[model samples]
Target: MKFQQVYFVVDDSFRLLWIGGEWDESALANGGSDARSNEVLSTSLLSHITDEPTRRATQAMAEAVQDTQTALRIDYRCDSPTLKRRYLMTIQPMKDNRVLFVHDLRDAQTFPVTFSQWRHQPGADALKCSFCCSVSLPDTDWTPPEVLAGPHPDVVDFTLCPDCEARITEAVSALRDGRKPGVSTTSGYGPEGTAS
Candidate 1:
């Protein structure tokens, strides 16, 4: 997925301020027409985030960055029907308590078998991580959508699974303690590399 490094800025209150770097192209390609910069500017970042846990975790990361005045990096997955893409997001502190989010494409590969297009289902019973795209059923463990046995669910509640939550907690804790979060390609969630 030859993505052009995308970046966006937020105000002290986490309101969308500006976005650049192929944002429109990426949004369109990822079925995010309503998420375009023009459509989302001035809105609360939490409004665009579908999951409560993700929202709270994002806030914690940003706050940690602000307090530590250091950049925090984490890897995540953004997949398409035929491609699996990895991205690294850096949350950097800026002057005036604002934050800058920079997303760089790390790697991409074609899926062995193309996944059917997934549609969002409001009020669905299934759970999915907005960051890693892992899905959890009523009683099943969090599993990658690629490994699921059947077609993707029509809708899923976008929230962090236990693993993702733990990852975020660890990363934020390191930052709050004035440590740099390490970068790792091993997991498509938060930092797994040795903290420095």
Candidate 2:
């Protein structure tokens, strides 16, 4: 069975369309899907959360597309309402219909996730590891990427993971006792080159 994804449309009236992901089967087939009512939505308001960004994006796109005839090509970005990562959204006006596509900006945006999220999302990132003091996202804090396809701010942050934190502590303790980290023994010596 298929479920409808939500979409906003501009017609005589502002409408919300739940043209579910799948159209052939399996859903609350109660009525037609032009969710055009002033009543509160029954489902989560994810899109609404990104209303500001979406509006700004659409405005900018509309301005650019005003000159285009028969079709409009617009590329914008926002968040997932649930996830604060970058999303690349494209809207195209077809002859008989309108289309929109949204994608995650992981590869597009170098640093899509937040420092806290990077630390906590079930991985060995900043959260699990205590040594990682930060994640350097360019342009956010230090340097932003040269040209961004999406609206991802460059951010550089450090989160201390556990092991690294322990190492730092140990190093500090050793320093208190007049000891340095350690010496490198292999001065170009390995399995093949066994000497200086």
Candidate 3:
């Protein structure tokens, strides 16, 4: 299987400048036909991110890169209905106050059974982490969507779980403190935010 890569550049002010490397193909494959390069160019990077927590974390990461002039790396999952795809995202500071984001596919797995595509509606009872693909019911701990039994929620909210939020914060803080942050893609957090 060929692992695909996608990259985009943004000015210091977070305006989209350029995008390349399988971006259009990935978008089309991931049900993002409207996210083509022609349509997204010259827009705010935050505008493309629909999840509120995700937008905040992305802005923080970009700002941290600009402040420290250091690159930050994080691993995330962007799974489709039948495929589990892992990617490493590198946020690199560039000259002329530009930041380059490169996403490298690290792994892909085909699920034994296909899942129906989920819809994300604001204020939904079910919450899903945008980074980890974990799902949580109301007043419950996060659980991997793979292990979930039948009858998944038709509408779920996209947000970060506590563990993901902490990990992202740590990674950004390390950059701010002039330390290199390690990459973590591990999911499945327990009730207390411990890796299960």
The order by descending lDDT is 3, 1, 2
Per-residue lDDT tens digits of candidate 3, residues 4-98? 98889999878989988887666212232357788888988777776889889988998999988998888777777777777778899999879
List the global CA lDDT of all models: 0.73, 0.27, 0.78
In candidate 2, how many Å is residue 170 off?
54
Top of the candidates by lDDT: 3
Q: Residues 8-101, candidate 1, lDDT per residue (tens digit)?
A: 8988788989888877655212233456678878988767665567779888988888888889987767677787777777899999989998
Clash pairs, model 1 backbone:
121-155
Candidate 2 structure quality by residue, lDDT tens digits, 1-78: 111232333221212333333222211111112333343233322233222322333343433323231223211122
On a 0 to 100 scale, what is the lDDT of residue 195 in model 3? 22
lDDT: worst 10-residue window of model 1: 25-34
Q: Which stretches of candidate 3 lie over 4 Å from their true place?
A: 25-33, 188-196
Q: Which run of 10 residues does model 2 get worst, by summed lDDT?
A: 23-32
